[model samples]
Target: MSFFSRRKLSEQELNNYQQQLNEFKYKITKFEDRLDKLQNDLECKSQGEPLQGVNVINAEEAANRVEKAAQKALPHELKEAFDEINSAVENEQQSVRLFQYELGAYVCANGKPQRKRIYHIDALSKKLKKYGYETKLDSNGPNSFLEVSWKGKETSDISKIDPAKKYVLPLEDTECEITDSATGKAISYEVAYACPRDDKWRIIYDRKICSDAVIVPGKEIIDVPKWVRSIEPIEVDY
Candidate 1:
């Protein structure tokens, strides 16, 4: 064969190239227009003032908080812990109930990791993802655990938590305290302690990342409850 196969480009191939170039140019133009519009819109919105939902925490209050934290002896540690706890409550609004997860001697079932063969907490990650969560994944067992998150204060059409198949969580080896909010009234309500913490669920992720396998959404969003779920549906028991 000759070094150069002297075949001219076909008309159809030339047309295809021209069409592709034209399409690409059109896309570029569209993108530029979008960019320009976005910049203008942002400028207009900025000038127009805050969005409807945005609550602007005043700079004075924010600065005061920082100053207070600075005066504390263990400012850094206390602030970080406080922030974490506050964040957890905001996401899992089931009234700030705290529980522990056992991480030592844990095992994985099927394709996912779990604390025990039974206390399926892997479901928590899925749920949290649905409710707009990401940032951290506290080790959920032994020396650590997935930190407790918000349980939307509604009865999620979840059935009786299954013992065999539910994703595993660290069993509360000993009794844990769950304090009541209303105590200092005419009728004295005492801080409550509960044991055998099994009837709760949490949604957790591997670690702080934008995307992961565990919290992936389902097709119908309803199928989610079946797969990405919880045992301790509201508060921390595990």
Candidate 2:
């Protein structure tokens, strides 16, 4: 055949094309039948009847059960950890909690940073993800706060924290004699503020970020308390 010239089809070729068409039609029909069966199966399930050998369940109910199972499967010491955090958040009307394993350590949401050795991080990741929150696990464990993507926005360098506001813990009746790790000085300091916008906690020495001030862990802490020591939420009144 000349370049760009259409060649007449041979009788055998026409027959072959027809056969291929028939095969495609048969496949399309088979696919449609399967799709219809699936639709009917779903409809029946929606009507409170499951297909043979399949138990129908409400999606939400199923999810609840799965969540329950996940909660139950947590190590005994770690069990109810998430629930405890949630309860505290609910009680305080806050969206996040910051827990430090040690007095001065990487803050984490689910568990203490040092406890990463005992707790299964993958399991924690699963539970957090299932709860519709985004998380990042460092070598130590989960981050200090649970990240939530809003408006279908991709996770980027753009901060979710408010720059104007500071995540300071209640100064009322919160005082500690803990030594400043950054400086080898024994000093008495009250609980300081966390700047989630900057992803750091500033140790306030007489209301100033002194040489001994240290940064706290977390991506954002909009309205969360300045800091918490346990995954169990402590209700801080503002």
lDDT assessment of candidate 1: 0.32
Please give the clash total of every predicted structure, in order: 31, 2
Give the RMSD in angstroms, all C-alphas superposed, for model 1: 26.0
Off by over 4 Å in 1: 1-6, 49-238
Per residue, candidate 2 scores C-alpha lDDT tens digits across 109-190 of 2222322112334455555444334555445333443332211113322253344432233222223333433463544443
For model 1 the local lDDT of residue 188 reads 18
lDDT (C-alpha) at residue 166 in model 1: 19
User: What is the TM-score of candidate 2?
Assistant: 0.23
Query: Each candidate's lDDT (Cα)?
Result: 0.32, 0.36
RMSD of each: 26.0, 27.5
Indicate the worst ten consecutive residues by lDDT in candidate 2: 229-238
